[model samples]
Target: MSDQTLPKTPRDDDSVLAAEYVLGVLGAEERIALQARIDRDPDFARHVEAWENHLAGLNTAFDEVEPPAHLKDALERRLFTNIDSAPQAGLARIWNSVRFWRAGAFAATAALALLAIVTLREPPSPPATGETLLASLVTEQGNTRFVVLYDSSAQTLRASLVEGDTPAASDYELWFVPAASGGAPISLGLIGGEGEKAPHVPANLQGDFTDGATIAISLEPAGGSATGSPTGPVVAAAPVKKI
Candidate 1:
């Protein structure tokens, strides 16, 4: 597939596959498929290059130390003693005996490769700096009907309709009421019926979304409140608080 088909963010599977391909741990068939993809997909190729660049620095971190001469002799003795004792008729079985050692070595190499990849990958970005404001708009009976989150970084107001029952032929209009008494409630926007709705905060009214600002939802005629002000009864109201 082309780069446009790839996910916007690097996925975990893609990241692992890129690391494995860079480390030469993939089997013949898997390696072929990944290489083909890299040739056709620029994004995958970039990911592979990034992984290689990230892991290349680890090669100079430590000097290799040679094992003692007797250690190799002892290991060979342990590994081949059984093979040497086996019947001549079982010569074909020697390959089976060596498979475990090969597999063990491969596993160790793969593990080290994985550790290096994970250690060298870039760290996650930190969360946005400003405090997020939250509000739980509730009915007069004190039952929460909607949850609102104001993200100052994105300058958006997100409202989630927690209580599912939205009146047919009517719209839910959201309003922002400043903390100062006597300030008129400002029209924010209309929220969807059953799911979450994120509306961009008006650039002119961004300053109205401060702590202690109240959010209220009103049921209005279909299409929204007509007079630019809430014309229906306020169904739910809650004060904004920093979260």
Candidate 2:
């Protein structure tokens, strides 16, 4: 979905943006862009505060561990050392030494690792309210299966099946069969005969919020939709979104 199609908020916008940011779910490029914007936009700081408070709530689950005494002293010493450093005099000359090349290589590797972490963090679970929708696909034998999908800040999409009812003797798996597709339907994951569980949606299905994609529950072997497509009868089906 396009940004123009998304709802723009006048209040709590900053808080909402910051909350998502702190969750570490924002894409690497998007986070960098927000950082640049924060430098010039004091108004955006409100959002940062909102994000901080949101994360602060999660801190209650953990007990604080005190740092080692030397560790604290070392940190303070390093902080003072950086503050006491003299400004560099004029333009620094580039060194042709092997040590300089080694340092440059190390810095580049560190940057690549940081980017990998930022981009590879797990996706957020769906929020309980707002534009999110929760549904269930029931088998023909009258078993209820649960699933959820949510729109990202980028208006992209993701889905997961948490729980479902399978026949006493058969296995049930979920598939995302695109209406215009020629290849196999993407197998989301397995479901249980009862209870709740959230499975990760396919990354490839992100941003495809059109009306054509169909969510179907297919009976497979004891494992799941192993063929990467639905091999059994689609007992339950629904569109990607309400039309």
TM-score of each: 0.44, 0.35
Give the per-residue lDDT of model 2 (tens digit) for 2-80. 6575456765566667667778789999899888877877878667866777678788899889988999877644422
Candidate 2 structure, TM-score to reference: 0.35
Tens-place lDDT per residue, model 1, 1-243, is 475754555576688789999989979999999999999999889889999998999889779899899999886444322121211231111121333333423433444456547746858547667757766654544332565678887776766556444555667788876677887777777765223322446788788677666667777786777797878777666666665
Candidate achieving the largest TM-score: 1
Q: Which stretches of candidate 1 lie over 4 Å from their true place?
A: 1-127, 142-144, 193-198
- Model-by-model lDDT, in order? 0.64, 0.51
- Local error of candidate 2 at residue 241 (angstroms): 2.6
